[model samples]
Target: MDYDIAIVGGGPIGLAFARSLAGFGLKLAIIERQPLAALARPDYDGREIALSQRSVRILDDLGVRHLLPPGGVASLAAAHVLNGGAKRALVLDPARRRRELGKMVSNQDLRRALFEGVAGQDGLDWLVERDVEGIAFEPASAALSLNDGRTLRTPLVVAADGRLSQTRQAFGLGAEMNALGRSMLVVKVAHEHDHGQIATEWFDHGQTLALLPLQPRQSSFVLTLGDREIRELCALPPAALAAELERRSKRRWGSITLLSEPFRYPLVTTFAHRFVAPRAALIGDAAVGMHPVTAHGFNLGIQGQATLARQLAESARRGSDLGDLRPLRRYEQRHRLLCRPVFEATNHIVSLYTDERPHARALRGALLGLGARTRLPRTMIGTMLA
Candidate 1:
């Protein structure tokens, strides 16, 4: 085999996984379509990742945490979930002695940190500006054909390509993909009033709005609406767009001014029917693409990669076959147990909150009220956030 293992993505999750295998003396390959320079210093893509404590610990273990910019990390002290036209909100506060629910970091910053940690590592090949055109899996190894007419053989191949992973498709793995008919627009904004380091999610009549606290006077504004509506908002000039945002938010944070270019994404959630196939296994978005409603996408990706890395490292230490099904099955079962519940619950939440029927609205308000009055539910949510 040309390599012991081959990872088919170079995003944060893939990079972190590669870094985890460092010092194991395994010949690894990271095949990425993105250029090397972009991997080193990724541009901001207007998405902020809410990382869990477990995820932070994983990054720390990988030696990537310290590489993040100090100012780029924001504390999520509390979260408020509000229903349509309701003054009351279901508040999730930090547990006793805990200062924050989680840490919020820009996507680009995390990517850069992971890339920095993985680059120049021993016994690893960083193949940039390349695409995996085909894969031929054998009982003993897999042959990965590059777009440039080169084939690399590996005992195990990991698919972290993304939600729309072509590698997973090539492996004949089916996924349950739900394309929600809404789009999300994210922008950096400066507001007059303080956000109090609180993240607020509002489910109004026909839209969803979230304000994630970043700096003292700045926050990330996330608005979800119909595709045409989002396009219209994106088409507006800066001043007009800011005014529209201020109006839509009901001036909750007082006046708002746009501070950065807006970015929009169509909301889609996906889950593979299986996490592994033969000599190939899936990780990151390729395994489970989560809805951002609960802000678990990035965190779950980190957890999946870490879980797979641990299993693979153990296999290497035992001098076992790198493509052994034993370790791969364990990784799949554990990751599936960790992901399935969250993925289903998030989809349910999105369904319930986004339903605009009268009965649905009433039920939503009742659920929110019940959650606010119940300490157990709030505590559980807070614990989950922490």
Candidate 2:
């Protein structure tokens, strides 16, 4: 085998996985289709990732946390959830001992940091601008044929590709997919009023909105609506879009203007039928795609990659075949336990908030009220976020 392990993506999660296994002296290769320049200088894609304390700690360990630009990591003091212009809200923050809930960082920064951390690492190869055409597994190794007419072998293969993973499908693994029939419109906006580091999730009639606080007078507006309506909103001129956002939030930010081009993404979620098969294991969005409402997708991916890497490292240390199914199953079991409840919960949250019926509205109001009064649910949510 040319490499001990081959990661079939070069995104943050994939780089982090390779980094985790590098300490074990395993030769690694990243099979990425993107050009190295794009991989190295990731553009701001109007997406921000909410990093949990655990994720931050993992990045810190990987030496990637230091790459964050000043003012890029925003402190989230608390998150408030309101239902249909309700006077009351469900407030969730960190535990009593913590001053902040968590941190938020731009996706571009995270990807750049992760790439820089591993770009010069030993025993790792960058197979950039290359696509995996086929993958075949033997008893001792997996052989991957690249589109460039080159082939490489690795004892184990890890899939960190996004939700629609070609690698996963090539392995004949199945996924339970959900097309939520909704889309989210996201844009960076400059506001006249400061957000005070408070994030707001408003479930208004026929709309679900989330304002993620950024530095001072900046925030990311995430508007969830039907596909057709969101397409129209995405097509709106910046001025009109800003006006709509300001009106949607009831002038919470006083007045707003677009800071970046708005982008629209179909809100889809996926859960792989299995996390591992034979010499391969899945991580990141490939294993389970979460609804962004919970904002745990990337964090969970980072943590899950660590889980599988530890098992792979141990197998390497023991001189066992790295593709041995034993460790793969263990990693799968652990990750499944960690992600199943959250996946179900995120789906429920999406379903509940997106329903516009009167009864559903009343139920949402009552649930918000109950959540505000209940300590357990709030604490559970806080624990998940932090």
Clashes of each: 0, 0
lDDT top scorer: 1
Q: Please list the C-alpha lDDT of all candidates, in the order they appear.
A: 0.91, 0.89
Q: Can you list the residue pairs that collide in candidate 2?
A: none
Q: Name the regions of candidate 1 deviating beyond 4 angstroms.
A: 382-386
What tens digits encode model 2's per-residue C-alpha lDDT throughout 106-144? 899889888888888999888989999999988888899
Q: Tens digit of lDDT per residue, candidate 1, span 40-146?
A: 98999999888877788888899999999999899888899999899998998777767788888999999999998988999999889999999998889999999
Cα lDDT of candidate 2 equals: 0.89
Cα-based lDDT at residue 218, candidate 2: 92
| TM-score, model 2 to reference | 0.98
Candidate 1, lDDT over the whole model = 0.91
